[model samples]
Target: MTDSASLPQDTQSATRPALPVRLKAGCKINLYLRITGVRENGYHELDTLFYPLSEPSDTLDIEEGAAGSGLTLVCERADLCTERNTLHKAWRVFAETTGFRPDLRLTLTKGVPDGAGLGGGSADAAAFLNFLNASAGKVALNDEELNEVAARIGADVPFFLKNVPARATGIGEILVPCEVDLSGFTLLLACPPEHVSTPWAFKAWDDRYANKMDIDATERLTLSAHMFTRPSSRALWLFNSFESVVFAAFPKLRAYKGSLIRHGAAAVVMSGSGASLFALYREMEKAMQASESLMREGVKTFIHHL
Candidate 1:
C-alpha cells in the first residue's frame, strides 16, 4: 500500500474511507470573462475568473454498482443521463486506462440548471472524478495526470478538479490559483427559464469583436493574487463578454440585472453567457431580499458565499 503522503495530496491511494460515498459537485460563476481571439483550430481563447460556488448544486451519491464492467450514472435530466456527459465519459476513460472495472453506481441529484452558463455539467463531472480518485483503493492518476485527462475531457473539467477559484486562459483550460476569500460577501445568482446556447453566443461575440482591433486579445489580463486577497464588494472587478450579445436576445435577463441593482447589489452581471445573472453584495440580508423579489416574480435563483 502506498502512503497517501507519497502520492499527491489531492488524489486517493489504495485505501480510502468507507463506501456509500456522497459528494457535491459545486457549480461556478465567472467573476470576470473576456473573449480573446479565435484559435486556428476554431476554438476561441478566453480570459476569465471561475469562482466555485460554496453550495454544491449537483449531488452525486456513489456506491458499488451491480457486478459489471462499467459505471452506472443516473440523473433527473434525460438529456444528461447519456454517456455523452462529462461524468460518464471521464469514468470510461479512467476504466479503460486503468483496466480496472469500475462497478460504481451513481445517483445524481441535479440542483444546477443546465445551459445557464453556471458550469453545472462541468461541476458534476469534476465531482465524480475527484470522488472516484479519492475513494478508489487503487489510484489511476495523480493530480497532474488527472488534470491532463480532465483537460481533454472538457475545458471546464480541469477548473473543477480543484474547488478553489482560478484565473483561466487558453480556451478555459489554463488554470492558475487565484483565491479570493469572498467570505464576507454574498453572491445572488438568478437563473431565468431561457437557456442560451454557448456556441451561438460565441459566434455572436466573434461577429461583434472581429471589427474591433482596439481590443487586444493578447494584452496580459492583469488580475493577480494581491488583488483578490481580501474579502470586499469591490475586491474583484466584474465583467463578462457574453452579456453584450446575450442581453440583446434575452430582454428578461437584461431586466433581471437591473432589478438586482435596484434592490441594492454592489455589482451585477451575467454569470457566463446568457440568462443567469448574479449580483455581489456585502450583506446577506440585502442579497436574500433581492432573491425573494425575483422569486416573487417567478425566477429561479440561488445564493452563494465563500
Candidate 2:
C-alpha cells in the first residue's frame, strides 16, 4: 500500500541515478466501478475509483542507448515484446509530443497477469512516461500536459502517473483525488485462472442493460462519491457493475466469492471486470485465515495490510 509518491523523485534532482534506471510498475484495483453511459464513438463512460497496489507489479530496467539507436524493448513474454504494446505506444507518443526521444533500451519483467482487470499494462506504460518526462529535462511536460499524452496510451494510464486513489470519469481519462481510508482493514485478493475481456464485459453489460442506459447519469455519479464519504455505507459501495454480467458467464468466479465470505471476509467483490476478487477484513488474522483457505483450493492470493 505504498503511496505513488514513494517512487523516485531523485529524477528531479541534478544528481540522477546512473545509466540503468529501475522502476516498479504496480497494478490497481477498482474499488467501485459503474458504467454511466456509452459514447457515440463506442467508448464506455465510467464512474470508477482506482486504488493502487504494489504487489503483482512489472519491473522495467532502462538504460540510455547510442544516438540514432531508437527505442528497443525486450521481454521474455512474447506478447509484450510487440510494437503494439502500451509501453511502445507511450514512448512513441511522448516523443512525438515532446521531441525528447532519447535512444534507449528497456527490459521488462512481468509479475502482473494480463487481462485480469488489474490495469497492469496501463501501470507499466505510465511508469515509463513518468521516467521519460523526468529525464526530458527542460522539455518535460507539466502534469496537465503529461496527462493528456498519457490518455493517448490508455484510459487507466493517467492514474498511475500520480498513483493515488482517484475518482475517474468520462472514459476514465478525467481524474480527481478521492481519499477513502481503510486504516484498520486488511485486503486479500484472489486471482483465479480466468481472464475477462474488458470489451466483452462492457458489451455484455450494454446488451443486458441497454434500456436502462438513459437513466439519470448525474444522480448515479453523485451517489458514487457520497458513498465513500460515509464509513457505515462502505459495504454498500463494494459493488462492481461488471459482476452481474461477468459472474453469469463464469460460474466458478461466483463460487469463489461465496467461498471468501464463508471464510470470514467482512466484504468481498470482484476487481475491475473479472478474474480477480478482493475481500476486506477488520483483522489481519481473518485475512490470513481467508488467504490460506483459498490457497488450499489452488487459487493464487495476495494479502495487503492497510
Candidate 3:
C-alpha cells in the first residue's frame, strides 16, 4: 500500500495543473435488513445486504490548487450548502489525513432526493475521498482506513466505500462481499414526497412492538445461496425487518409499496427504514415502463438497470 504521508511533497505540485477530478457516486438499496438490538452506545445492531445501483444521483468535482481553502458546492438543493454538505467534511478529512491541501472546488449535482433512505450523502463522501486519493497520488489509505473514516461519518458510509453488494453487520460497519449477481435485473426506485426519521422509526418500533416481537429470531433468518441465485426463489425471501414497524407508523409507505406492485413490479419492498421503496424487474424495459407509469401517477421515480 502506498502511504500518503511518505509521498514526496512535490506530488501535489505535479498534479496541480490538471483539470478538476470528477467521480460519479452510486446509490444503494438494502436487499434484506434486520435490526437485532440496540447497543450500549445507543447505536442499533443490524444485519443487512447492500446492493449498489448502476446510476447515481450526485457527482463530486475535486480541482487542485491550497491547504485550509474552503469548498464551493453547487447544487440546486439549498439544503446541500457548504455547512451541511458531506463533501465539506470529506475535504476536511482528506486534508487532515494526506497533509496536502490543494485548492479544490466541488460541485454536487443533486439527482437523489435527500433523506430518501438511498445513501446519497454516503456516496458523495466516499466518492470525494476516493477522488482525493487518486488525484493527489496518495493511495495511502487502504480499504480498512477508508472504511474507518466512512464509519465516522454515518452508519451507512462504509457501504459506499466498498461499492459492491455486501452483507453488513455490527452497526453496519462490518462488511462481507456477497456473490449475488444482478447483471440482468432492473431496479425501480420511488421516493415519495415524505421523509421518515430513522431515529423516530426505531423508537416507534421499540414503543409499539418491542415486547411483541423477537428480534433475535428475526436476525437468525438467513437466505439460501440458491435463493440469491434465482430471483424467483429470492423474491419470496427478500425482506426488510424495519418495514412492518415503519409501515404501520407511516401508512403512506405501505400504500407506496402497493402502488409499486400494482404497476407490474416483480417484488416491491421498502429500502432501509422508510420513504423510499424499490421494485425489482427482470427486464429493463419493464422497469422503465413502470417508472414512467409511476411518474404519471404523481410518484417520483428513478430507474436503473443493475
Clash numbers, per candidate: 1, 0, 3
TM-score of each: 0.86, 0.90, 0.81
On TM-score, the candidate that comes out on top is 2
Candidate 1 Cα lDDT to native: 0.74
Q: Report the number of the highest-lDDT candidate.
A: 2
Across residues 4-82, which tens digit of lDDT does each residue of candidate 3 receive? 2111223334453245555677788888776666665767767789988755467655554456565666776777775
Clash pairs for candidate 2:
none
lDDT of 2 by residue, 1-306 (tens): 122322453344454445677889889998878777777788888888999998878888888877897788989988788899999999999999989888989899998887688999999999989888877777778788989999999999999999999999899999998897988889998988888998888889879865555557776556445532333213877678788789899998888888888877788888888788888988888888888888888888989988
Candidate lDDT scores, in order, read 0.74, 0.82, 0.70
Off by over 4 Å in 2: 1-17, 215-234
Candidate 1 — which residues are off by over 4 angstroms? 1-12, 135-139, 211-236
User: Ten residues in a row with the worst lDDT in model 2?
Assistant: 1-10
Tens-place lDDT per residue, model 1, 1-306, is 121111124454555635577776678888887776666677877878998775537777877788863778887778878879888888876666555556888788888887788888887777677666665555557778778878877899888878688999999999998868777888888988888998889888768764453444444233222222233223246767777778788888878888998888988878887668788888899999999999998998888774
